[model samples]
Target: MSWIFLFFAGLLEIGWAIGLKYTDGFTRPAPTLFTIASMIASLALLGLALKTLPVGTAYAVWTGIGTVGTALLGVWLLGEPATATRLACIGLIVAGIVGLKLAA
Candidate 1:
């Protein structure tokens, strides 16, 4: 259950991370509100997960998910470069996340 919460929290982190670009420095009201809501929800979910998960493992996995999702979304939606090296690094992050989950 805590892992589920952490996973969703990580997803929300990706939402807000990508939402920042849509917010246009927060000049856009709707995106800004959405981003802010996501931020709060993400933190709340992270707190819930922290009740059982080790802080180090949870934090790394949370940020890892966010980083990977955001980078992929940036390439797919924002026309960012998807270089081989960049993708390999993302894969490494995913591996680390998996390793942490297994260790925990």
Candidate 2:
């Protein structure tokens, strides 16, 4: 299904985002390679999903998943701040993503 592809693409978007952090300005060879690969895969999958899904909805959902996943991962794995305000903003993004899905 297109949704499935979109969902995985979103996950890959998360992968590449974290990969970017690991890249250290592309100085780290391994993480940089991983980041580039994931970035390609993510965009490819997004293109595939665009065959059926509306572009606006798909893009928002994709970035929403990436944004939420990366923020959570930053808190859990990278020791980023997890303030209530930040959490609230993430919740709003979630709501918007869900709303787009429902509208579609």
* Candidate achieving the largest lDDT: 1
**TM-score between candidate 2 and the true structure:** 0.97
lDDT of each: 0.98, 0.96
Error of 2 at 1 (Å): 0.6
User: Tens digits of per-residue lDDT for model 2 on 38-83?
Assistant: 9999999999999999999999999999999999999998999999
Alpha-carbon lDDT of model 2: 0.96
Model 1 C-alpha lDDT versus the unseen true structure: 0.98
Model 1 residue pairs with clashes: none
Q: Which stretches of candidate 1 lie over 4 Å from their true place?
A: none
Q: Looking at model 2, report the run of 10 residues with the lowest lDDT sum.
A: 1-10
